[model samples]
Target: MATLNKGILGGFSGKVGTVVGANWRGLDIIRSRPKNAKRNPTEKQLEQQMKFKLAVSFLQPLKTIQSMYFGSGSGVKSRVNMAVSYTINEAIQVVVGLPELIYNKVLITRGELTSFQNAVLTTQPGGVLHLEWEDNSTQGNAAPADLVSIVCYCEELKNWEIFEGIVMRSDLMADVTLPAYCLGKTMEVYAFLNNVKQTAASTSFYLGQHLVN
Candidate 1:
């Protein structure tokens, strides 16, 4: 019997009439199937696989947002792929509870929103969210009168509170009182500055989650 070697498109397979295909590590090629016996994966290996699966499932829904905010390359497809890879890797690290995974939120793509300096969020005793930032409008593209938009998400209740079009960079600070139901739960906060025309916005910054105080 004669054996033929095909290109990467042909994956490995058992010999059939002297032709076979095989794929390895994403490369498709022609090869004969190995005769080694298969063994069950170790517990650690299975756990890692589960973590990767969970990470993918959690990040699938955010693909649009990722592409919109994280797209950086000259080509759309490359930008999207980079964003997906970033999100997936972040999710996997977080799922595995890595000690370095201190930030639970996804990394925000830096953009026009970089004008604001030292944005901070704090929870007041009365369950009020106090957002403050140093206005660097003169140094950056944003104007002092640019609109500020804030979003708060309560993870436990799956509730969202949005405060938009009511604050400006000139104000330097804003306060948002949480509803009674949102008290005692952890919430994630995001903030961004938008142009006066409302046609453009800076990158949304994750201000970290806080337990309602």
Candidate 2:
């Protein structure tokens, strides 16, 4: 910080280049902008950053689905934000000094809608995924018109296949045809149900990893 007598630029009172000019007690004052402090993050902060990175990377692929099906999306936080918060707090685990996402605990959707019952997933030859579930749609609050959505992630190939409303809950079964590139890759599969009106969704079910045939 320095005091300026205004020799040439008659009473400058704003920022110009690297210095800031202002009037202070009938005197022009010039001060350099404060430099940003670059400090190493603490151990806790580093762990949190790692966890956030892992959560975001896994959820980013299903961002669109999350925005529509994660929670109620009625509070101060958006559905995507809710999903990220839930993932960081509930779905991530620390192993070997680094954060890793737990596949079975990770949820792609959440709501009051009824989810799958006795769901079974198997792969047929040529990259076909066969999903079978009990027809519990007529029970309780479940509706036959509930839409089924599937998500497949291939970590080795870094590929995603997201299918929304491909089948109905009453259908009891679904077949997801994967792309040719996913034929040889092992895939982590998940399924969820949302109402036909798209107002709510059930918690996603992890169908486990399957070696594509």
Candidate 3:
């Protein structure tokens, strides 16, 4: 399978904090042409006419963490966690600023959930973020109904209401999406802000999958 590396490059090295998302790939469908049609349809044609099926494969959006600390001392005790407020189902384009957010060091890649599982991104710290499942067992698929959450702390814990808790499903993935049209062309991707800071040149936000008919 082909994969795209979305990691932060070299220009922006110090600002990027963390990232998490899935690498989903499914079979693409193709329509039967009239030239292939026949009066006496064979069993294969009959099957295709009845139902459409395709093999879909994808790596579950694994979790990841990358931290840039204040001091660089060997074995300095520092903890960082990501309080994710959103889930990404599609692509997001961020206009990163200079000095604070160096675009070069940042890269967007898939989160690796297991060892055998292939990952898209290179983690800076160590292993992937270990999220304790609500079910206790570490094996099997995570319940689709449950919300994925994380918490990141550097020095002190501030009162962050929006940072923690179930990021309401509505707040992340949408059931229906309106077409994005501009200059007589249609776009499939949608970009929005989950968290915003107007005063700073640097900030963090969340992104997720979008729906469109």
lDDT agreement with native, every candidate: 0.65, 0.88, 0.22
Query: Which runs in model 1 stand beyond 4 Å of their true positions?
Result: 1-74, 78-83, 91-105, 158-160, 197-200
TM-score for each predicted model, relative to the true structure: 0.57, 0.82, 0.17
Ranking by lDDT: 2, 1, 3
lDDT of 3: 0.22
Model 3 lDDT at residue 46: 47
lDDT by residue (77-191, candidate 2, tens digit) is 9999999999999989899898977778888898889899999999999889999999998776799999999998887876679988999999999998999888778888999
- Cα lDDT of model 3 by residue, 98-180, tens digit: 11212222222222121111111111222222222123113332223323233221111211111222332123332221222
Best by TM-score: 2
RMSD of 2: 4.2
TM-score head-to-head 1 vs 3, winner: 1
Per-residue accuracy of model 1 over 101-176 as CA lDDT, tens digit each: 2235454332454456899899998789998988687875778888887777665675667777568888999898
**For model 2, which pairs clash?**
none
> Per-residue lDDT for 100 in model 2?
76
Worst 10 residues of 2 by lDDT: 1-10
Alpha-carbon shift of residue 15 in model 2 (angstroms):
14
Candidate 2 at residue 8, lDDT? Answer: 64
